[model samples]
Target: MQEISYPEKIDPRLHIYPSQEADRLKSRLLEHHETGILDAIGRELFTRMDTAGLVPIFVLRGGLALKDAYVEAAGFGPAGVIVPWRARHTEDPTVSYASLPVVPGARYALVDTLIASGRTIIACLQALRVRVPGARVDVVAPFLATAGRERVIADAADTHIHCVWHAEDVDGDGRMVGPGFDVGDLVLGWQGRHLVWSGERGERA
Candidate 1:
């Protein structure tokens, strides 16, 4: 990774959560994806979206936590629920039904707390393949783990992963351009930088 760097300012909303809150959230979302740092990263993401006519689409299971956070950040009236069910630890999505209720003809954004291994995204694609069909997919997350980022490309394949910022590393091995604040595996390395999902190739459906 590159040298460490911090932005002129870290978003204010992220600071709203007390250090204890981050610890508690970290424990809950440990196996649940990336809720710990999502709060920290969500501020940058919310700023990008502007919440102007924005509806949220959480990928169920994995995205449930993110959806909850997004709603808390943006509110329920501004954001609606649409969950896509897909297996996380298993390869079979049929076991859980891969679909979410999209209000149909409504503009929405997909939010996930983290993209750790991109398995969430792969499973998400399987579910969305039938439910959403031809809709545009916008992904949001806090930290895109070093190992997880590789799969993000394959998972995104042909869509955009619009997040606040993607960290180069969070393992504390000192590889990330910036170090994530100590919050277990969850941390905010940097803010206000984005990378295009070049994996979005052709005929994702």
Candidate 2:
């Protein structure tokens, strides 16, 4: 990777679970995906949506990851629409999400590969709310940090956060962990690349 450059100010909420634990968790995350653990998690998320009258909308993030494959095997359905969100820049880092049809008072599952700082997830959820008022949001990721979950909840009280691996599961030296070492890099390396399903199953891709 690109030498793992980091921003000047690190978020205070970041954590490093411990070296041994971090290594173990990292290995297990890969193992889970290969062993269909992530698939089960995705199915469970879908089940939750069915019960709550929500729909799944996978976020096509900018990173070069196999998120599309993971979501596809889990049965999310080719890449279609893009939900734009403002990334954290040194200057104004206001977050946003693309406008989409919102079922009145319904739930929407915002799926992504991982959540490091939760900045992007928070931005997307908040913007989504603005576009579709009164809709509940569920943030799903295969891996994420505890701080990310807390931040999402803090930013959107009605948002439900779920993940396979928490940041507390990994080891880091505070500022040097999580995004510092490129936590999602492994997904990028996973070989089963596939087109991310856009919109609903029958929707155009």
Candidate 3:
């Protein structure tokens, strides 16, 4: 539970809770297998959001676990679409799925577990923009890297970004600092690529 200082030019659209509070909640989430604590965190985030007529858009794999908690906490139904994305050293980041027709100028909450380099989220945003011009998007996650936050803010200045904790830049070893674990793998049980299961015979084309 540490205090995080922000620069004078920090974007007004970026919202985050205190690290101490986030740490407490995150620990409970891990201990309880991401059930109650996830809902609690979601409630905290959704209460601050203007959720009326909002559409929830979950990113696949990593975001799958968050869907139920987020929807229940927000008092909404299931997401209409899940965007499958991949961002790895072996391939350029991409959003592989096309969503159902989007409503122009509608509000969307793009849910993901973590934002490390922001490449995946950025790629998702690009696809969303193409489908729903002038749509208002809010990038929601539990943990986010400082660099990733900055990158999203720079790329989508009007988008609102919300997270429980802010992590330091990715380390040289490619570890995300604050969370201290691979959230995707932890939530999903096993992971290779988002599109491919660990024990699968081969990656999907």
- Weakest lDDT window of 10 consecutive positions for candidate 3: 1-10
Evaluate residue 139 in candidate 1 and report its C-alpha lDDT on the 0 to 100 scale: 55
What lDDT tens digits, residue by residue, belong to model 3 across residues 25-81?
Answer: 777765555545655666565665666777788776567667766666677543555
Descending-TM-score candidate ranking = 3, 2, 1
lDDT for each of the candidates? Answer: 0.46, 0.47, 0.66
Give all TM-scores, in the order shown: 0.51, 0.52, 0.76
Off by over 4 Å in 2: 1-52, 62-99, 169-205
Top candidate when judged by TM-score against the true structure: 3
How would you encode candidate 1's per-residue C-alpha lDDT over 1-205 as one tens digit per residue?
A: 2122122232222211123333443444444545445554455456545565566666544455455456666776544334333222243223143333456564456566655545555656555656667765555655445555556555555555554334445343322333333222232332334232213221211
- Tens-place lDDT per residue, model 2, 1-205, is 1121122223332221222333343455444434233344444333333333545565645222334434554444322223543322222224333534545565676777566566666767766666667777676665665566567657777766654345433233222233333333334444443343323322211
Whole-model lDDT for model 3 versus the true structure? 0.66
Two-way TM-score contest, 1 vs 3, winner: 3
Q: Model 3, which residues run further than 4 Å from truth?
A: 1-9, 19-21, 28-39, 173-175, 178-180, 191-205
**What RMSD value applies to candidate 3?**
4.3
TM-score of 2: 0.52
Instruction: Please give the TM-score that candidate 3 achieves against the real structure.
Output: 0.76
